[model samples]
Target: MTSQIELKSGTAMAPADPVLRDFRNFLFLVWKHLNLPEPTDVQYDLAAYLQKGPKRSVIEAFRGVGKSWVTSAFVCWLLLNNPQLNIMVVSAAKDRADAFSTFTKRLIAEMPILEHLKPGKGQRDSNIAFDVGPAGASQSPSVKSVGITGQLTGSRADVIIADDVESLNNAMTSTMRDLLSERIKEFDAVLKPGGRVIYLGTPQTEMSIYNRLPERGYEIRIWPARIPADPDKYQGRLAPFVMRMIQDGKGPGTPVDPKRFHDLDLLEREASYGRSGFALQFMLDTSLSDQDRYPLKFRDLMVTSLDPRMAPVKLMWASDPDKRLDIPMVGLQGDAYHRPMWMAPEMAEYTGCVMAIDPSGRGKDETAYAIVKHLNGWLYVVASGGFKDGYGEATLKGLALLAKQHGANKIIVEANFGDGMFTQLLKPVVSRIHAVEIEEVKHNQQKERRICDTLEPVMNQHRLVFDQAVIEHDHKGTSEPIRQLMYQMSRITRDRGSLAKDDRLDVLAMAVGYWAESMARDTDKAHEEHLESLRDKAYEDFIELVHRNTNSGYEIDEPSWLN
Candidate 1:
């Protein structure tokens, strides 16, 4: 369609051809001219956005959609409308770049309306580099195809099209991602003034370059298989691709391309891809990746507040009777710890308790500990926190105090860091202060594996309960103490950068493992020892002996200590 309209000066001037001027119209004309299926609503909307021309933009559409075809049409529309505009097409590799150019060149050659805009009569006619018109003395190819790693410096473009630059293999590792990002930066140097930089690809990772480009001033447009109903919650957050979808009047949860994608097809794809893969491929929900990697869930842990007055058993630290001053005895603060499982509403008779420790040598690293109790097969997360004094005097005394307060007879410290010195240094300090026992444990398993293997089963069965007070205190997950410990447990990933340290998490896992293993390790011994204690009590029955010797007060059979 040649555009020629009469001018006001009685001379004829060509108007921007109607078909080439509006991108949507250009798409419709091209689709009609080639005798192809009409573009979907999403396809047309994508073409419209690119036509509007944002300085920098990201087009993340679901795979199999005709986004690339529409983009190819848009390139043709631009060259036809602005004949001299230089364009560079970039992809993950040379072959992919050639494919884009091949399709584009095919479109121009096959369409009758685009015949005049074909490659030069005597100049370059290759798919990689082609001309829009006959070659001139000062002519360079109007379109150039280059891989992201290929030569990008010697040429300049009025528009740089980066199509699918992120590949799965390149995005899996941090180093590869950095290399891709650096390679993509060359477009900036080669772009002419005021030209638009367009990026089109599916995001491969949570930290993919597609997700990070917005920080550098690229406007991103995401088209997922389905658009969420309420999008206000996702204003600034990038992943999940939740946005106010305008193409279809259909509400959220409905397919963006209802005509092409069926309900069963989508569900089958989701099941086939699994959670993480489905999120990355279709739903555009990367948030599910952490849930899949992190074994602990926020929902698995029970939350409850405790009051000291309601405590069934209390331990008090009192001034020695030999002291003359009137210092008052301080009872256990129940609110600090002691969260019984929700299933067991009331506190039960506890058979064993231990405090597990992961000690640090420097104040910068935390020395974390957890006091766990075992009743039957049930375990209680009594209390957990960190001491910043490392393995010094304060750390030793702190563990002793915590053990006494929680009535825990055993304090198990990780021997890996200090080479068994953690418990050795605490032995004299705890013996001099209280009768609490300190034990050393040499960890032979990976820290992450240790935590997941021990804690996953117990948590899944709802046998572990955590203190709600501590969670509330660190609601934002900021501190590196026990409060932050729970946060780490809920987000500990196999990926390196996700969690740099797991000291507190290690202590918590060790504590849970202590009681979990005790059910197997000490079941028989514990039962025999418990029965032996009862037998020992029978011989020292002061009340029965006292009653029998009521008539002979001085000859009572009561133990000398009691007397």
Candidate 2:
């Protein structure tokens, strides 16, 4: 029964018994059997965690760390050690779970030492569910693969392996994350007494379920692709060994497992995934402090009382303490609204005012609208709010009133929702109330990407200003902060469904987008032009004064003293 492994230098003797007793040894054997290189330090560490960690545990290693592969080998080791154990594999999708179980089954079938545990005749042997040869008759198969939302109830297991169960698709919004949280709670019901549940995943968001499992008594360990510069972002969540390595002077940007992924490989991945994305998937840092993750910041906005028809000819933005406005803020930490550092004494009428509408049907979404005014390369948000009445007469009337109240001359309605039907329904109401021209616009890019692209640059330049009244109104407009315009604007990422309710932000982006062409004007250039115009006016005034003082009515020549 002994297995002999032929190495380049000599013959290495494997265990004679099918059960190796050590999961790490089993994993190494599997890797060697597959003609793969020797197991890396991180892989061995993951194997050790699988074997000796808490009964309820989470393994949050970076993507491409071979966590799933190591766990599959651990599964084989577990079954070889105890054939009567019933195991379940769950994932965000059924296909993923099936793949996990399929790999486990393939290992048991192909590996000579594990051949004894293969399903015998008259036993369930499909990839979705199967029974081991020595497993006793039970209601559940020895091994079962099911999706998180699949039929999980009524099935009992001695061990559950939830692999990649929290993906961007399932855990995108608060509601989706809540549903996923509740779904995993069923694991407590399905698991037998003293049973173990192991979760293998890379966090998809800051509010990832893996991050919260520790509160529920499940011990968690995280292994990032590279040593973290800010280890506090992990909040002592790194694996004990990894933390020791960090304390041992292992600096940031050093690959924890260079054999698998070198510095250049990780850099390439970082470039492909983007910094924030790489932080989530590879660095395993979900801290929202990363500025690049959420590009829009409340600090970037100038908050002041904006006139519906007039604004200062020149406004300058500053983030100094004196410029920071003491307002109710729902943005990320250290993000606060700021007032403009300077405003011209003379005010001029706005060049144009536009309103944007993101219409939504009766549901959790809101029929949001925003009114923005443009003047001298700056865009001002005068009014913004949402209606829950959908396309009803009350909602249409509310929108029309907002346009008239804000002196909006043009209304832009998103055509993606109702295919111009919402615009058509609103035209008649607007004609009776405001008589503003309504235009239907459609977007082809992803919603989050489009919103970020349309607003990030404008906000970055501090050209997008929010009315102090609009900020106050938005805070009081909705009981739920996620539906508020500022909250949505500050929290939105490039990921799809990053925000549960983006209606308010969408309309704001649309309103700002209408002035995108005018936004290209350089603020510095505008200031220089203003200074030049002021100099020209002063010179003209001086000439007029000298002409009035002169005895002759003819133009006076330049004096040498004046020059």
Candidate 3:
């Protein structure tokens, strides 16, 4: 058990038992036999409050205020008065819960008046538990202590007690937050109406279970550093002990020391996690921005694998001109939003899909292409590479062969450099490739503007996950193309200077266009039955026209374009 100190102020404190006869015996044990001193102002107040009906309350205070000692006495009072009543105690973690339970048992064993109750006896080993006269005591609370494990298993009790729930060391994640929410729900279901819930913890986060509970209609009472203050004469003596304890927990560390502690001795310094710890614990503020689009939220760009056995491959198609750099064409795969799954050839049957390519002319800056594939409702990178001598006839042949191996069926190439040259160059490669179909596409607008317009909805829906290494591939830790795209989006109208060049964003745009086209095809297929009805009507019309000319065998003419 962690060491605890009891302040012996030498004033007479009230006894644990409420009845006059029992109270006298309890006091005799404390003062004469145990030689313990009186309680402090905080302990006295808590004792008085508990004497009322069994209403549960919370205590939010600064650290080192003897919260544990005060709470311990309260529990003892309850147990002695009503032995059959069950109490549930929980903490942020299993170890902490066990510590609190152990401390309570120690307090019971040390007090002489209650020693006859034989509170610690049942364990085959030493003193983990206590029992009273013959196992069937006329007076015993039947108190049992357990951790919060398995779904709400230990939550049923006439009283529920929770200690410091948020720790800087064991910070809460979204999943953790969800688990806490579930436990609270169980409390609501199992707690008998009018039963009490005592929540005692130092505030850690703004959205902590403490602050959130009151919004759901739990009566809230605040104990700030000072009850009232006047700025003119104030020396800030309020909460002096609490502030001193917070400083002491820092353990003689300087600001430069990477390991500094905050209030509650549990809060840690915030770095890359943003102001999450500080905002949630001491300041008590909630997040106002959408986390998905947060500029610095790295997890927003992360994707994780739901299954451990499954691995997924990343395929990318993009055009780059300067493929000459040693690392110009590096493709990385890791968890961006989900845990990463490494995909082998066998898993391709479930995850394998086609990748579209866009060829470049100069390949001077770098050859560029775009690739997109759907996995678990998200489009992920498959493969992307750039080269100095961009794809022409020979390079196209190599690319097509690689695509065929990956089971890709379509390759869309831009014909803007010159349709004649493109067709001539691609004709031989297309003839040689039977697995993939090649199509030439032409464009006359600014590539950046067009791609951004098409991809805006995709970004909004979080339908795409990109490689973080690739996004921040440059030295400055910023993706230039993405920055430009964001700049363009801010302007409702394109009325200004030349927009930023966005090679990567262009590839993303093409992928979005392809996805949109596929959705349109599905919609058309959904109405195929109605189209079938129209087809029969047209066939009947054609028969009528042919029958009218049957007598003369009217000369038929092919369409002008075909002729």
What total of clashing residue pairs does each candidate reach?
Answer: 1, 0, 50
For lDDT, candidate 2 versus 3, the one ahead is 2
Model 3 residue 445 CA deviation in Å: 31
Candidate 3 local Cα displacement, residue 128, angstroms: 6.3
lDDT values of the candidates?
Answer: 0.68, 0.86, 0.45
- List, residue by residue over 210-327, the lDDT tens digit for candidate 2: 8789889988789999999998778777888788888899998899999999999999999999988898889888764246668888888889987767888888889999888888
Best by TM-score: 2
Of the two candidates 1 and 3, the one with more favorable TM-score, higher being better, is 1
Per-residue alpha-carbon lDDT of candidate 3 for residues 390-487, written as tens digits (9 for 90 to 100): 65555767666656554555666666655547556765775677455666667677664576466655554444555434433332333433233222
TM values, all candidates: 0.57, 0.71, 0.39
Scored by Cα lDDT, where does model 1 land?
0.68
Write one digit per residue (lDDT tens) for candidate 1, span 226-305.
76555542344332323445443657677877777777788888888886787778766555554455566544544445
Please give the lDDT score for candidate 2. 0.86
Ranking by lDDT: 2, 1, 3
